[model samples]
Target: MIWIIIEFLFPALLIALPLTLYKSNRPLMTKFYLRMTASGSARKLYARCMLILILLYHYVYAGGHFGEWGILASTTFCAILFSFRRADRWLTRLHEERKIFFLTAVLVLTTCAVPHLHTVAVTLAFLLLAAMFYPSRNVLSKWTDEENRIRWMNNPKIVSEYYY
Candidate 1:
């Protein structure tokens, strides 16, 4: 339980920071992410953290059959694909690009299909991480106004939400 929460810190902070601080780097960072992604942002600091965490879970934690491990392993790709193409993009893109999902499913299914499932499971876990990652922005962008203010916080006051 504690590990789950601890592992969630980066993802949570990525969402919470802007929402609480009401900062919108949409314009600049849109270009920045493109540049970064082009320059290999998919393998950046946070992405590495998530990958390492997944590897830790599989090698140090699950260390066994694919079923118990692959589902959790694939979530990184699920999240990347989910964010890159909005979850709404599922119908449009999933059928075409969902090979990653199927690959995860297959590796997980191979528990009964293969021997020494742990090695295959770990291999698939790392392969799953290689697909891609895209962080969702604008969890707070919609709340920012023309003056770059958090319109919801009337009086232009800095409230306790800042520390949140």
Candidate 2:
């Protein structure tokens, strides 16, 4: 029970950090996250801590063919991916690209929450999701110029909800 509470509370606390510290702007949140993790060592430390915490949780709660190894592998792969500039660009894009990445990441997390899915399926989904971000860096760099910014700002639908 304590572990479960910690598991829930830890993420909530982390989420609350940026929300409380920043305005309700999506771009600000992205920038805040990037700044917080600007250091490669800091990022690695965070990933290592997450890996330890998650593995401990899985070992205690998920018994018998629950695919703990697959989960670990996916986490490891994601940590490795985070080391690349491409991953950072994909994650921190200041435009619609970031929204797409955010949506895809949320979807992946949602799907990964299904306890009934085989571990292998979950692992494959995670890998595919990670791979999906690979091409966006180049594409977004090309699209993030001032002309595109002007076009994006001119959109009526986007102007009202300008935070995202």
Candidate 3:
């Protein structure tokens, strides 16, 4: 069971982190990528493609755990899609925030209570946390005066400024 979780998680991290990092620090990452040789880019791209292909292969083709794999893929896809939304409305949308917070709290508590399903619970908690934090992340990026680095932090927005 643990190995199953690890197999899913490792591929997810590979796919998610690079994309997030490139979004968060585009100029620097772009420059870095540009400096790499063509062969290097090919190798890196191939590796990432292969990782995703292999993981999806397991999800679609592997036997004996089809239901769990399907659930994992669906939830992961939804989480990734939802992560693109701006969470700035969390301030004025107090009712919505309350519901989200309550659900996240429940997941966290459930993770503590159920050792057998720890990995699934933890993954869900992380997805919820990302949804909560994504919109406010770029707030600090605009505020920072420093060069060569970008800061990210959560600072809620006004009602009119909120993302609808």
lDDT of each: 0.40, 0.43, 0.40
Whole-model lDDT, model 3? 0.40
For this target, which candidate reaches the highest TM-score against the unseen true structure? Answer: 2
Per-residue lDDT of model 3, residues 38-59, tens digit only: 1334424433443354445344
Q: Which 10-residue window of candidate 2 scores lowest in summed lDDT? A: 127-136
TM-score for each prediction?
A: 0.29, 0.40, 0.31
Tell me the tens digit of each residue's lDDT in model 1 across 1-164: 65555544533443464454333334443443333323333425444554565545444434233355444534555355334324324322322366855867576567526543443454343433333233222312323434434342342232222211
- Candidate 1, residue 87: lDDT: 35
Ranking by TM-score: 2, 3, 1
Q: Higher TM-score: candidate 2 or 3? A: 2
Which scores better on TM-score, 1 or 2?
2
Clash totals in order? 0, 0, 0
Model 1 per-residue lDDT at 48: 54
- Mark the 10 consecutive residues where model 3 has the least summed lDDT: 151-160
